[model samples]
Target: MLCIKKPSVASSFEELIPKILTEGDLVETEFGERTKEIRNTIIEITNPKLKKVPEKYPLGEKAVEEYRKNLLYGSKNIFSYDYHERLFEYPYNEERINQIDYIIEKLNQQKNSRRAIAITWNPKIDIEVSKDERGSVPCLQFIEFLVRDNNLHMTVVFRSNDALLAYVANALGLISLGEYIAEKTNTQLKSYVHHSVSMHVYIDRDRDYIKKYFPEYLKYIE
Candidate 1:
């Protein structure tokens, strides 16, 4: 378990990656490279607005609907009760089954409830680990919101996080959620506690991915 306490002057969350990835435990997956799992890493960010964004995400002012569907909200298409008889399963529904609505409504109603939560993984679709045809399973598992001292704090859990591609993007999405909930519940954004069970940068047999992508991985390593 990695419990890293960053100083207030530490900048972006990405800057703190090398500290864990370079010193964590290694485990081989059926996927490409051996992943470095920090297991249970709880790193604190001084600012809720984590100021790091990757080139690939490229969310212009966070208006990308596609990213929203994948991150905070699940697909709008969902199965109805009659899904068994229909040939075209996974039908469309008007309401999103994600936790954003629950968060907003419950937190607005009762700020002290400990159940303002959001879940991303659906076990019916996510059970197949070997099936690449299932678009992509969610890397983030769950996020819970708590209010302490009139401040809304978020705790994010990730099953596996790509330190290069997904770390900051996921945090940004959560920050958006936190801010939205905070505004609705009349609270201030306090802290973002991220616990990634497996945070890694993928590398090929020749270490080409990181060599090409993370040229300055050690840039903020202190």
Candidate 2:
């Protein structure tokens, strides 16, 4: 597993992009040809709130803000799944579980709770559908919250991640969620850890963009 430890999300993302370009193995997927891939990559951010968008990041500040809002509170759209719906109103056996509430309550009751976990994957539905038929499947699977030394730490697991295009946005969104949880539980926010089972960049889609904006890393690609 490749581990990247940084003080903020921007730094981690900046480092991650080049690392994947240089160290990742070429792989083919149902989507298309990916330039590079690394499995079980971990990113640890010591301070989630210190997130500043890197100048090289493709998206603008407004776009990133919109994504964070959508991840935290957007309504369900045409897609098969939405992260906000799965987290705030998780579907169970004929019932919806407010996982965010549960996590807050658990932490308030027991600061040392080890069971404050929220899961996005519903096996009954997710396991039965194919991506072609479903339109979208949940890439983020599990989220766990821990409190130690009066600080709350969050860890998230993703089955797959588009490291180049989606990772920075994902990290920022989850950091907002963690901030919400920390406020609700009256704990200070600390580290944010993200784990991706398969972290990759789609070469055919992003090659020109990377070449134009991140020429410094061209040595790795050529």
Candidate 3:
């Protein structure tokens, strides 16, 4: 019997994780069977105890503020990728780097308590890895994060997706990224996602495969 229950706002994502662990059955997502495994891991790390749920799961406004404070004061653990480069890319152009510096300086100049954010999500410019490519895999990537009251919230971006086949992977990726950023920045990460409309074209075609392994996946949004 499936005993899964939805989480309440009073509890954080961490608190909900255990319900997923003990009461929740692994529901298939577009991504694949791996979703269950990853979800299980997230719960294990967030809430070690299933006894009493925490008041805040850390995905709150204040949590996001803490994270930004850390980024401004400590290391910025930003991760990026370049499909064309076939590896992680660094130093977003000199101009971009300069902008970051400028923002930092401006924040101090104005004596402001907020942070500046720059994202990489232009499909036209960002390189995509393709399957037919003789040398690399075909994929799309981008980043998204939240900022409230000038405090940087959690950010999550992704590379590659099977809108129907691997939707779970995408969700897990975003959620995990939010958790990590929240932990590092000491803030809560609000969630958002961007996807290709063309993905539907492919997903519709693979309806059979999706239904066979991921029957519960479609129930996600429905």
Candidate 4:
């Protein structure tokens, strides 16, 4: 199973910076070389502790064979075209309003300090294809969220985004939501993500960053 935990605030971004160091990392693959390289670079950028380049990347043929089993895969089940069409066609409707309410309810039910978020980036339905000379298909969904200590945090999801191009916008959007929810709840809103394919890929990209610059985070793991 894929597990994504809430992000607890650090005393400061700098303190959080040291936790992403990279040392003694190991991954071997040719097919995954680009992914691994991006991972390493991100670690290097965030954590200064590693000082040296990792040796396991751009792996040997033998190493790739050995690690093949560890590679990730996803569902092949096809969706009704209606499924994809609806996400774009009726993004904001009564159904979506209920969904936002449901997420708030889930947080209230948790009885813990953690807050929840639902991400709606199903790749099966949200593929980005060129639309025209002046424009293109929507790349991601848009949503708003707020964090408050004892109130329901608000989050709004948008359709279509260029992952790298719009990363900052998405990040800030969630942060704002966490803050807003916290104020409404009269308690700190702990940040969380609802899993969707787009988010999955974003996190994978983030994982690469953590591996490259924040290996110390791996140590904090249990």
Candidate 1 CA-lDDT value: 0.59
Put down candidate 3 lDDT per residue, 17-94, tens digits, no spaces.
333233333445343333222221221122211223233322334444443343334334432332212212223454
lDDT of model 1 at residue 120?
Answer: 57
How good is model 3 by TM-score? 0.36
lDDT against the true structure, per candidate, is 0.59, 0.87, 0.35, 0.33
lDDT of 2 by residue, 1-222 (tens): 799999998899889988888889888877556568899999999988897987777775676788789878885455677888889988888898889999999999999999999999987777766546535789999999999999999999999999877888888889999999999999988999999999988777888868876777777766
Clashing pairs in 1: none
Task: Select the stronger candidate by TM-score from 3 and 4.
Answer: 3
Candidate 3 displacement at residue 46 in angstroms: 18
- Cα-based lDDT at residue 168, candidate 1: 61
Tens-digit lDDT track for model 1 on 42-116?
A: 767657754445443323336433443344444455422211111112223543353566677888788788998
Q: Relative to the unseen true structure, what is the C-alpha lDDT of residue 12 in candidate 3, on a scale of 0 to 100?
A: 31
TM-score per candidate: 0.71, 0.94, 0.36, 0.32
Query: Which regions of candidate 2 deviate over 4 angstroms?
Result: 131-134
* Cα TM-score of candidate 1: 0.71
Regions of model 4 farther than 4 Å from truth = 1-94, 113-115, 122-165, 190-222
